[model samples]
Every structure is written in C-alpha cells, then in structure tokens.
Target: MSGRKTGALLVLVLLALLGACSPAPECSSHQDCPPGQLCLSNRCQPGSPADGAADAGADPGRDAGADPGSDGADAGADPAGDAGADAGADAGADTGADPGADAAGDTGADAGDEAADSGPGDCLDPDGDGYGTGTSCLGPDCAPDDAERHPGAPELCNGLDDDCDGVPDQGGVCPQANPYLWVFLLAGQSNMVGLGVNSELGGADASGVNNVHIFCDLSVHNDGNPHCLHWVTPLVPGFGVLPDRFGPELSFGRRLHELWPNRSLAIIKIAEGGTALADRWAARDGDLYQLLVQQVTTQMNDLHIAWSPRLVAFVWMQGESDACSSDTANAYYLNLRNFIQALRQDLGVDLLPITAGLIADQPMWPEAGKVRDATSLLADHLGPMDVVETTDLPRHPDDLAHYDTAGQLELGRRFAEAVNALLADRDWEFPGDFSRAQGDGFWRYQACQGASCSLLSWDLFRRYWKNASATVLIGDGWVQPAESQAAEISWWAPWDGRIQVTASAVLAASGGDGTMVSIFRNERLLAGPRPLTAGSGASFDLLLDVEQGQRLRFITDSGSTADGELDRTTWQITVHMSRVAGD
Candidate 1:
C-alpha cells in the first residue's frame, strides 16, 4: 500500500478510539479544550488523564454494564481507571491541593494542613516559651517540658539557665527592686565624727567626687549638728559637727567613689564625740546604741524610697573614752562584740563586714594600754573583722588627743583599704615593721621560774613588780628581769613571709651565772639562747621564713636560780620584727 493512504487510515482509527473511550472533546493539545480542560492522548479532558478516564468510564453509553454517575466500573474493562482516580486524588492532597480537587494542583497548603492536624510540632508553640518542638517547624525547642527552659532564656543563680543561651547563671540573679546602690554604715565616737581639722584635707584629692551621697541624721543632737536625713554630696568640713572639723568619711567616700564610678555610693554616718563603748555606745542598754539603730532604720527606709541601696559594710572608730578608765578598757572587748552583734541584728544581716580603727595611744589616759589590748583581742577573735592601727598616729596639737589632720587623712585611706579588702575577700595588713618597746610594753607576757608561770598584764608591769623573782619591769626605757625567770611574748603572724627579728638588752649575773635570751617560732627555737654575763649586753639577729597564723615567741631566761638579774641602767630591751621578703 501507498504511505499517504496508510497514514490516513491510522488517523481515522485513533479518532474512533478517542470517541469511544472518552466522553470529552477531541484535540491535539490542552489549549483546544474548554478553559479548565486538559488534552491527554488526543482527548479533551476535564482535569487530567486520570480524571477524564474516570468520568468517561462512569458514563453508561461508554460502559454498557456500568450505571451512569456510578463509582463501579464495567466488568469487561480494565479496573485501572478507578485506581488512577484514587492515586490522583492522593497526589493532589500530598502536594497541598484541596481534597475536593480532581488532581494534584499547584497550591502549597497540603503540608501545612497535615501539620495543623498533627498539632504541637508545627509552628504552634503550646508552651508559649517562644520555641517550637517539631523538626519540620520553624522554631525547634530542645526542651518543651519546662516552659522556663527555652532558647535565649535568662540565666539566674538558682542553679539553672532559665534562658537557654548555653550558659548557667551568667548574669547573676536579677534584682527584685530597682535603683540599687551600695550602702556603708559609719559608726563609733570622736574620730569617726571628724575630729581631724578640715583644713588638713586641702591637699587630699579624691578622683571621683560627684558619685557619693551621704545621709546624716544628727537629729538626736542639737539642730546645729548637721542633722538631716536627706541625700547630699559629701563635703569635708560639713560632715562633722563644726564646719572646721572632718572625719575619715571624706577620704573614704572619695576613694570608694573612685574605685566604683559606675556604682552609687551612700554613706550613713551615725557618730558622736567622747562616747564610750561601755555607756554611750553600749549595745543593748546605751542610749546612743538605740539611737543609732533607729537612725539607720529610718534612713535605710528613706534611701530605699529614694534609691534602693545594698548595705555593704560598717566602719567603726570609737573607744577613746574607754581608754580613760581601767574598768571600761577591760570590758572594751565584750562591749565592742555586743555592739557589732546588735548592729548586725538590727540590719538583718549577720555576716556584715566590720572595719574598726584601733584606739590611738593617749599619754594622759593611763588605761589606754588596756583598751589597746582589748581592740587587738577583738580583731583576732571576730570573723569578718579588720583593725586599722592608730597607735603611732600623731594627735592634733590643739586637742592633744584627737588625730591631727594628716593622721585623719591617713586613717580614712586605711579604712577604705580595709573595706575594699573585705569586699575582695582578702586580708588587709598594716604596712611597716612592728616594734614592741619596753620589752613588756606592747605585748602580753607570762614569766615562769621552774614551771610556775604567772601572766603579767601590760598595765601591771608598768606599775609594779620590782622585787619578785619572776617579775619583769619596764622603767626609764629599760626592761629589768629577776633571777631564774623567763619572760615570753607571743603574737599572731600577720602575713606569710621571711621575717628578720632583732632583740637587744643589757644583762648582769649576780653569782657569775650567765643569762640567755631566745626567740621561738611556735615553741620551735629559730634564734637566740645567747648567753649573758655581768656587764655584758645580749643581742641577736635572725632570719626566719614564716606563714600566717603561726605564733612567734620572744623569751628572756635568767640562767641561774635566784642569782641572775637584768641591769636596769641602759637596760632597754627592744624586739623588732620586719618582713624582708616572700608573701
């Protein structure tokens, strides 16, 4: 047969097949059909190939055995038409098409609809913690059980990272109240009340001056006493009673302000002149103590109202009046302890850091030695306590007792140092060499003759004990020890370091017996046992490495029983210990 005739016959057969198999119009492409119809296998379909086949097969004219508009297919025809319709519907649904659509459409809502039906893992955050749990979702929450535990949560001190930013307690606990500032409590007597002449502070320069706010409530005293419970920038002369006097607060506030420029400094000064710890500043019974507590509470409330502040430390500098009497001086330790405990109780914090200045030596006050002893005892026994020494500080020429302007300035600097050390959790040590003059003067001593030892206080030895066998007396700038007696002085080592100890004294033996002077480190002999004879002077210089908390002992032993003696003429005994090196 010819090629043209064969092609015409094939086209006629295809047209016949289309007319019988499909009820839709016949076309070469999809554009030839109605607006929504698509051409498939030369048939104009309503949707796609699968949709047209299903609809065409459902017609009773095309399938003789099948009912019109019925879902069932003809018995003799392939069952794939119904299967193809089911597959097309599933594909449309999986691809985010409307379920009612005949075939898979171009809409992207299928996955979203499935996620909405499944719940939680979708973009929906049920916990409201700004995080989602599903792997396919936008925000994946690692821990959905705890609402507090989420991405970008705040880290607190409760041993948990509330905001899951991969750090635990990074920023510390958030303050419950705002306007947080640092507070300092200034208490005690005269020196604390600005006994120093204000004119002396002319040369002292405080770097950051504007950050300090002092709250003074001298209402208990006369109106002229700078009594106001309002915040004011600290000024030298105004901080005290008279405009010409100033206390340690000026330098203290200035230094603190300089150290923490970003933080606000608040000083609550509650001090008065000539107040003794036994009476005026007594913990429970004293009027001043009660008044101090009241003022602190009232001012603290006012401070909170104005600007919330955190109470950091308490600075105390009293006890001069106690130095005037033996009874008050003796009880200074207990009185100071009670006052501190009461202050902490009133403030509601038991472990408040207390930095106190030791009472300076008063030539007119005979019992000053006792007060000094009590102050040392307090520093040694109390926790979170620091003592700044003022024994060597020069007194103001005018008052003859109060610290001079230079002394007050130095005292204020020391107070700041001690407070700063407390905040940093470190020890504050007095610089320079420590010297104990008069042998039995600055130290507590116990003398023994053949295992019988008696503790001789610093005051008693200065008063009596010239004839006793174990008596050691300091007179005319000399130390005199009787026969067969050993005098020992012990103190706590301030720092861990190598110390150079030097001791010198003139000695004389009654029956030609030699005398020996020794230095011991916690009972272990480090230097001395140097022999002494009549008209011979004993002297020893030794270097020893020591640690803090170690006890050091300096002892003088008369070698012969009832026969040896130390000369009183040119007989000064001095023990000086200086830190040479180490830390």
Candidate 2:
C-alpha cells in the first residue's frame, strides 16, 4: 500500500470518531427554551443574541472582557464598562453559571435563577410577596414594589386591590374595628326561622336596611346536618327558609337599627324549622349547636380581627318541637339552661345577654306549658336577660304553629325590645332625688334627659337610690338604678385648677355595652364612654380644666330603651382636686 493512501485512510477514521462524539440538537426555536435561554449550536444557552428578550433594556455594545461567573449586579453605569462582568453580560439576563468558561464573555444568566439570593431572580420579587414583574420573569404582582398586593390576598379597605381581584375593597369595609358596631346572634326552631310570605310582609327590602349585615345558613333540613349556604349580604326581607319567605331577623335587626340608629348592627342567624333543643341543638359534637359555632367562627374571623365587634345579644325563638312530647317538655328547663350555659362557654362570653321567647300554646305543639314556663323563669330577676311573650303573639291561622306576617314582625320587635331592656338595665346612672352638700362642694345626682342633663327627678331614681357615702366607702357620689336615659352625679369644683377624676361603677348583675362611665367639665363633655363588657366594672380617668365653681360631673347613662329596672349600680367617683405639676 502507498503512504498517501494510508494517510487518507487515517483522516477518514478521525472524522468518523468526531462525528460519533457530537451531541444531539437541544432546542429548535426561542419557544423551545426557558425565558433567558437561547438556541445556540442546537443547545439551549443564555446571554447570546438568541436570548434577546431576556437582554431587553441592557446595553448591547461590548467593551472590556469579564469574568465567567458574576454574582454582582450592574457592575458599572454602562454595560461595556462592566469590567467586573463578561462582555454585554447584563444584570438583567446574563451570567456565567457553567463551571468551565472563557473570560471573554459570560456563558449566560439562568432564566429561572435566584441571583446569589440577592437582587435578582426568575421574577423580580423585590417586595418578597411571592410575586414579581418584568418580561423575563413575569409575575402576578401588578405592584411589584408593594408586598401587600398579590393574588388571593385579603382585600383591604384601602383604595388599592390588595387581593389582586381587579376591584379594590371587595371583601367589606376596612379597619372594621368600630366598637359601636354590635353583632347579635339569632337562633332556634321553625318560629325562629319564620314561614311568613314576603308578599304578606311587604315584599323585598328594596331599600336595604342600612348597616345591617346578615349571614345565614338555614339550608339544612329536618335531618339537622349543616349545609354549605355561604353568603354575606345586607339585610333583605327574603332571608327565610325560601327566598320568598321572611323571618324574625328582619324586624329584629331593623328594630335594633332603629333603637340605636347612630350605630351599625349585624346578625348571624342559623336555624332549622323542626329542630329540638333536646336533640338537634343538643350542645354536643356534630350537632346544630356545633354547626352554629363553627360557621360563626369562620364568619366572624375577619370581624373579630378587624372591628373587635361585640356579640351584644342572643335571641332565641324555639321550643315547638320539644313541646310536642311531654318528656322533652318536662326536661325543658334543665336542658334549656344547659344549652345556654354551653353556648356561653363555647363563645367565651359568660355574661351574654339573652332574649328568650315563650313557645306559643298553639295546636301544633299543644303541650308547651312546661316549655313556656321554663323560658319565662330562666331570668328570675337574675338579669342580663329578658323574655319575649310569644304565647300572646298571633300565630299563622292555617298552620297554627308558624307566625303569620304580623306575628313574625311583632315577634322580632318584641325580641329587640327585650334585648334593649336587658342592655338598658346595665346602664348605670346617678339618682336625682338622692344628693347631699358636703364641705365646700355640693355632690348632686340627676338623670340625663336625652344626652344632656337638666337635673330631673325620676320615680325610679327616687325609689332606688343611695348617697355616695352609703354606696362606696371612699368616694363622694351616688348609687342608683339605671334607666332609659343616662344618669348624672356631679361635684362642684372647690377651686379652679386641672383635676383628675377617677370614676368607676358596677352593675349588680352582668351584661353591658356602651360607655358605662364618662366625665364632663361643667357642661362640656370630656373623655370617654368607656365600654366595659361582662362582670368587669366600667371606669373613667380624666384630667380636665375646671372653673372655681364649675361642675365636674361624672355621668353614667344607658341608651334609650325604657325598662332598666334591673340596673342597680354601685358608684364611686374620687377627685384628686389638688395636684402639683407632673404629680
């Protein structure tokens, strides 16, 4: 064989070896690779012209050669001046992640990389809200700089769309921390749910009673299992069993709104028509009572966090089912008591105010005498409770068990009145007929007419009253029963100066809302209507300016709700009339 033929044979063998070692094509187009990656030599690569989208807004002109891998961002003002990084290697989309690379330019920026875990990522999550912006690392965060705005975030009452749901403030009002916004719970059986026709009760509530929010889950049937009837709405007429039917919550909520027009109201009404206190609402696990607490827990999750709303009242209109049988009716009192006890325990409100309605002695549930008696006797002068007389309220003529339009409406009003009475009874006040002049100042007691005090003597104040010395051993004030209007007990300023009045009062029984104790300088109102719930006494601490003979009055008043017979309060007002600077 010739030497030339032998050399050519060797060349052919080397070409065959190189062809066998070559890799397969990795990508075909820009779409075939990650955002920052490009198709170079049929392989998905980065930092080259193929990865143009990732290099957007970057200076493309090349200058100084750079290191292979760079953890630094935007090394210089100009892309070419980036001697710290490789040629045209942008913080935007170019880096050298490959182990082996030449110093001429960066291999590429990882399209889906967190750049040294600082300042760079597949997405520009600067706010760290798990969202970002930019063409290479596009994200759901419309406001990339803000951490609060994102998908599925809770919509705040702020002007922005916190949840990224297009519209802002969709989840309800923001900073729902208004203490005056009272929440009431309405529960019970068929009568409580009500079967009155909407047409018979004035159709739909088109005007939408203001500030009254309702969350109802009455979809459950006689089986007593809770249903997923999740929805929150402004108070409408047809929130009954059917969309066309009306219930007690309508008038109950409305009456409350009317009575306390200045403040807002809300309700959590969970009921079933045929449930029995002894069975369905047994206060045990997996029952209607559990459903009530569970649903309410979820519903009020935001409310409790935001507004710190109070559960002011619980109105119950039930007992027809238990009344159907003598055994249940006989055990009604104990069972009912246990139910209330369990509710208060679960809700963590031991001093919960309740308005229980008497079961009607209608033909539908004729053996209701025991149940009726139990309801009435639950609050035997041990207040924070009131009873609505349902036995007298008219029932549906045909059904004999359910309340007709008028009956249902009246029932609701009565429930509201009963609740009002209970709350009013806790409002403490100074007695007008009881007072004395001691030392250089006169300690006088009076009832507040509306919000102001003209110093009128009421029969209630005259009948149930005690002087400050008799009420509290340390203070010079008055002890009197709470009435519809707030009561005032003022002390004449012995000398002109700034004084601190530390006043406090206590209702003999539980259940209270609103400013129990407040202070005023002469006729000018000063600090507080300090709200105190439960057995905790209401108190006030105020530093006020007073004239030499000005009236520094300590006032206590329940809102307007006529019956406050049970609001017997002990009063104490200590005035530190003499104080040095900073003392």
Candidate 3:
C-alpha cells in the first residue's frame, strides 16, 4: 500500500473515466472522414462509410441505463446511445417524405414541356403554282366561292387567276352573239399606218365573224412602206398590213374585236401620209374614190353571207395635206357628202354609219385650228357621230405625225367606246347649214345638171336638201325611209386661205331596206355610202375638206318624199371660220 502503488492505481482509474466521457474524432466535413468513418455533426462516427453504421460513442451496449423510447439501447448518460437516438430520429424524419416524389415531379414537368413543344405546328404549302399558300392564291377559277379564303392576291393586271386551282387568266362570263354588225373604216396618216410599235407577222384570233372580209391598202414591202395598194379584192383577215402585229399596239380592229366580241365586223383601211385632200384618194374620178368603191363592194359581198352586213360605221383621219389651203377646209363638208352618196349607191344598205376623228395633238400638223373648227361644226350637227377628244394624249411620242404605242392603244380603246355609245342610239344628227363665202362666209348651190340644189336648215348647224337626191352633213343626219334610196351629192367651196377635213357614217337599220349616199368636195371624193336601205334610216358626216374657202355647194339625187311633196329639201354643210388673208 505504498505511495507508488497508489499513484499507479489512481492514474488507471482517471484514464478509464476520461475514455468514457471523450467524443469521437473531429472531421471538417463528410469528405474529411476516414475510409471507414462518416463525419456526422463535425465528428467522425465509428462505421463504414458505405453502411451508415453508428459511431463508437453511439453504441447501445455502451449505455449506462435502459432508455424508455430506445429500440434496444440505453438512452441516458451514454453519449453513444444518445447519438444512436439522434440518428434514428433523423432517419424517421427523412422517411416521412418520399425522396422519389420530387424527382417524379421534375420528370412530370419535363414531360409537360415536351408535350407543349409537340403541340399544333405550322401549316403551309410551297413549291406549288405562284398562287400557293405562301404566295398569291392564283387558281383555275379566278372567282372563288369564298374570297376571304384567298387573301394573298394582287388585285392588279398580273394576269393571274388569284384563287387556288389551276390556270391563270380564267375570267368571268362569256360574251353572247350580237345581232347587228358594226364595220369601222380607220384611215389616216402615219398614226393610222402604225409606227413605233413593235411589228410582227402573227395573226389575231378574233371571236365572231359573219364571213365579212377586211380590205386594206397599206404599205407592205419597204421597211417603212409609204404606199402599196396590192390585192384589190376583200380578203379574209385582210390585205396590206396585217394589223395583228405589223402595226401599232392599238389596232382598231383588234380593239373592236375585244370590245364587241360577238358582233360581226369588217374593216376597210386605206390611208397614206403626205397625201393632199385633192389627191387621187379624194378625187371622185381618181383612185381614192374608185378604190374605196371597189373595196366597199367586196365587203358587201362578204356581208351578204348571212344577209348583207349593214354598213354601220366609218372612221376618217386626214388633213395635214390640205390644211395649207383654206378653200379645202370650207369645202370639207360638201366633199364628205359626195362620199356618203357614193357608198349608199354602191353598197345597197340603209345607213352608212360614220365617225370622224379630229386632229389636235401635233403642232406640226398644218392649220390645226381650221381642222378643229371644221370638225367642231361637224360634231355640232352630227348626232350619231362621235368626236373623240385627243387633246389628253401626250403631245409627242417619237415621230412627228404618229403617237406612241401606248397612246395609239388608248386612242383605239377610246374610239371603240365612242362607237359603242353611238350604236346605243338610233337617231342620226347630221352636220349642216354650211355657207363658205368669206373666211366664215355662205355659199349658194345653184341647180345645174339635173335637180335644183339648195340648203335647208333643220337643227343647230344642220341643213336639209331641197329637190336634191344626195347631200353631205358635217356630223350625222337621218335619211328618209333609210332603206332603198339613192342620193348623189356634189359639193364645191371657194377657198383663199387654209383648211382640213374628216368624215364618217352610220347605218340606221339592217333588217328592212337599203339606201345610198355620196360625198364630194371640189375634185376630191372621199368614202361613199353604198346603195343601202331599210324601213328605219341611216346618216353620215365628214371633214373631207380641211381648208379655207369662200363659196360652198351641194347637189343631191334623192330627198324627203312625204305625201308626194318634197317637204324638207336642202343640203347640210359646216365650215371652219378663219379671217386670215385669202381665207
């Protein structure tokens, strides 16, 4: 029992007490734990990291007393038992919620996202016709049942059927056949001959035809043919320049075909530039009147195919030639009357319709005022005639006497519109009461050859023939008993200055009879209305003389046969006023 033995025993007891109270090894974090230990609450627990075993300090057998709630371990005094209880409590807390539930929620949210991405997609068709889903909706039928369905269409001249289907250019209802036939004779200077327009050798495919042929004496051989009257007879399609392509874009016949697709039509064109009003074409005994008669007769033969085609209309474009002579201007109306009479006698139809074109654009055209004044007077008297306004077009396109392609086309279209308007009405207003004494003077026509020729005033600027068979009106005039009648009108005007002339006609009826009317000015003889007649009536007007004159005369071959008494007997005339020196 000595002091050495006592000291050793005390040390042993102290060591054991210390070991019981000490905690497990310290660890910075779970990663700082050894291979077989886990860092729990900043201390290394005694257990394999893989098994999640309890620490040495948490061993149940090392507890001092049995715990009330501990599964099989002491709960008081022993730190190991307390540790095990804490571990169990944490495990229970973790078990209360499903660990996979949050993961499942994330997976479901992801699924939802995928579904949203897979929902309705875009609908469009490409590589189709220009009218596909992405482009304008062109189709086989231009007019669709639902216009809203085809929203991407350009409402312009794209020439596309803006509704989905097949072809482009498919349009509306087809045109019906027109019982009446309208024949327009277009003749003028370079503009009438068609210049500056791209020319070709193709032919037009018009819709309706009453077998009526077209006769033209246009320049053919030369690059710019001046005058070449070949193939004298009326030929199918036509002779001279084929208007289909070898002319300006505004081909009169072509436009007529489109405007009146179902109407029977025949056009006779004989125009030359630089030809004076007193040239052969103007002279009654010259080639102009003779050729016109021949061609008109040929047209009549074709018109007879389905009952002779009533000479419905005529167009005249000239004046630059005689514009230098004032006498020609005043005598224009008288000359025109002679032409109408000749046509009526030759054709044997009721009314020889006429529509005169006035020159007003190019200043290079001599005596434009005289031409305008004369034409204006004619319009004032001629009810059925159409005086188209050309002042709207550009002053010049290229040539001195010709309009551009666009201008020409527009001109043709306007002319067609005017004709259509006139055809709608039946009454013919003839130009008349023309007296060429001074610049705006009066002329007296004394009966010389057969009948007494004189002037009879009717409407404003209109005149009737007294004991005369044929007479010329500036505008349009109704012929008595339109059918089966003949009139030969001769005209003369004293000129001292400058003038210009234009002419046209209209057939009043077709189903019944026939009549004839001729026009003449000095030696110049323009177009003549062949022998035509009908129960109804017909009329005509002309600017056959575009010049200054002093005296004017008219001689007719037929007149008003009412109750066997010549009631209205007189010649109608219109003259452009000019106070120039010799005019």
- Candidate 3 residue-wise lDDT, 1-583, digit = tens: 9999999999999999987788877854334555556555357665533222122222211112322223131112111111111111212212112111110000000011111222222111111111112121232212211121132332211112223232221343112212444456666555565543433222442222232345566533223433234322222222223333222213556666665555556666766556545555564664666666676667656655653244556666666665666777666665555554455445442133456667654566556667666666665544334577665654344554655545565666677676666543212112452332111112232323322223333432334333234333222333332112223332222212222222233344444333334443321122232233333222332222122111222323333332111212223333332221111
Q: Estimate, for each residue in 1-583, the C-alpha lDDT of model 2 and write its tens digit.
A: 8999999999999999876776534854333566566544345555443233222122111211433222132122111121211222222222312111111111111112222333433444433434444443434554332333456554433233445555533454333323534678989887777786778755433346777888777746423322125544567777776777778888888888788776667888888888898888887642889988887778767675545355667888888889989998888888887887678667744346778888777666767888888877666522356677777777677777788888888888899888877554211223321322211123555555543444332233334333332221112333332444566666643222345555566655454342265555433334344433334465554444332234556666553432243344556656654431111
- Model 2: how far residue 102 lies from native, Å: 66
Q: Write the per-residue lDDT of candidate 1 for residues 419-440, one digit (tens) a residue.
A: 8776642222111111222111
RMSD of 3: 43.6
Q: Rank the candidates by lDDT, best first.
A: 2, 1, 3
TM-score for candidate 3:
0.39
- Once superposed on the true structure, which residue ranges of model 2 sit more than 4 Å away at CA? 1-180, 203-207, 219-228, 429-583
Show pairs that collide, candidate 1. Answer: 96-110, 153-163, 153-164, 154-163, 194-246, 194-247
lDDT, residue 338, model 2? 83
Candidate 2, lDDT over the whole model: 0.54
Q: What are the models' TM-scores? A: 0.46, 0.45, 0.39
